[model samples]
Target: MSQLQDNFGRRFHYLRMSVTDVCNFKCTYCLPDGYRPDGKPKFLDLNEIEHLVSAFSQVGTQKIRITGGEPSLRKDFTDIIRIVKDNDKINTIATTTNGYRLAKHAQEWYDAGLRRINISVDSLDPKMFYQITGENKFDDVMRGVDAALEAGFERVKINAVLLKGLNDKDLPRFLHWIKNTPIDLRFIELMETGLGHDYFKAHHLAGNDIKLQLEQAGWQFDTPAVDDGPAQNFSHQDYQGRIGLIMPYAKNFCASCNRLRVSAKGKLHLCLFTENGVDLRDLLQTPDQQAELIERLHGQLAQKKETHFLHDGITGVTQHLASIGG
Candidate 1:
């Protein structure tokens, strides 16, 4: 099988597939006003997802991360997990969610073959979480985290976007919470998008600040797994959990690029901040189109840029992170 290699010699092995663009939460950084549908969205159905995953698997894709505005909102989410899990070529099946429905579906998802889970928990403080996510489901979300662990997931991670003067100071609180929790807490840098320029300017905090503090506290860097996301992970000898920092602004951050994204509508995004994506929906309509779909995927990689233009203040067509499952 031919690996998905770009002109820059980056071989892709991970696929982030968005099952839907609809999110129920109104996060201040992402969907501040909430998700507004655009004339009845026509998201990819089960058949298309099966064909899409099959074509990708043929190209040496080893991991598929099911993402969404909140992937758990989809009624067929478990079936989606089963679809990716059923692919013999796929070795890892994971999903990122907002944790709204995790408590209710954690066991069902794990039983369906999901092994890894990532939940968005922007704040440890309940009020602050509500302020950041614009939802009062903090307790519910926390319960879901525990449920994920109890459900026997291989790994469980929590994602928190570092916002200035907001959850930035909650590092100590998070550290204490993770001491015995055995969870991987990841702090993501606030990325500027087409619609969040002012918000980004006001709230963006450097993930390096947290990294520096972690290093000072004796947290040692940990080697990443073969298909791990861009997070620089660190572990402490005394703690059960780990911390990961995702600093997209850091130099050479894209040098290790090995992941590709597919939007709910079947557009293939070579980079998170690309100007636009190539539509694969036409080729995803039938299993017979798998060969052409794989070929188109390879053709698109040839045009993948060396790096995203986020540092240059060019966000491309991404109005917000939720639109394409950031």
Candidate 2:
């Protein structure tokens, strides 16, 4: 099999595929106001997604992470999971959701072969959660998490974007909750986007600061898996759960790049902060297009830059994280 390798010798093994660009949560960082329709969104359909994933699987892709504004919002979400699960070449199938429908649909989703789930839970405090996400369904989200565990997901991950004055101080609360619960709590540093420039400057917290605190508390770094996300995981002997820190700003961060992202509309993003994405929708139309699709994907690697220039304040064309399933 021809592996997806860039000019820098970085081989891609994971694919982050977005199903839609619509989200319900009005998070202060992402969609502060709310998810406004950006000129009649035309996302990928079931047949398109199947062809795309199959082509990727043929190119040595091992894992597929389905993301979106909120992937579960799709009516055929379970069917989407089944689509990826049907691809025997793909060994790992995961999804990142807002937990809006997990309480009721987690079991159904798990039954469809979704083994790993990453749910966004910015704050453990109900009031702070509402303050950050502009929603009041904190309790319901927590119940959804409980439901996920009951539905047989061994480890559920919670994603929290570390914001300076908002939920930054809530680390202690999160630590306590994860002590007994088998959840991998990940704290991500906010990235500067076209729309969140002012907000990023005011609330962005360094992920390393949280790393320092975790290390001081005796949490040790765990060895990363071959197809793991960029998170640097840490584990404690006494706790049932673990902690992960996603530091996109850290030095040589892109040196270990192993995943590629494709937007809901079939545009391949070389990097999250790239100025433009390569259109792949045309090649994803039919099953017979698999060979051309794989060749197109392989040829795009030459356009992949060594690293993103985010530190230089160049956020590319990304106005909102929700737009590209960040």
lDDT of each: 0.93, 0.92
Q: Show the lowest summed lDDT stretch of 10 residues, model 2.
A: 147-156
lDDT (10s digit) by residue, model 2, range 1-326? 69999999999999999999899999999999899997988899999999999998988799999999899888988999999999999999999988989999989989999999998999999999999999998999999999988898856999999999999999999999999999999999999999988999999999999999999999999999999999999999999999999999999999999999999888999899865898999988888888888889999998899999889999999999988889
Q: What is the model-wide C-alpha lDDT for candidate 1?
A: 0.93
TM-score, per-candidate, Cα-based: 0.99, 0.99
What's the distance in Å from true for residue 255, model 2? 0.8
> CA lDDT of 182 in candidate 2?
93
Candidate 1, residues 3-110, lDDT tens digits: the string is 899999998999999999999999999999999999999899999999999999999899999999899888999999999989999999999999999999999999
Model 2: runs farther than 4 Å from truth?
none
RMSD, candidate 2, Å: 0.8
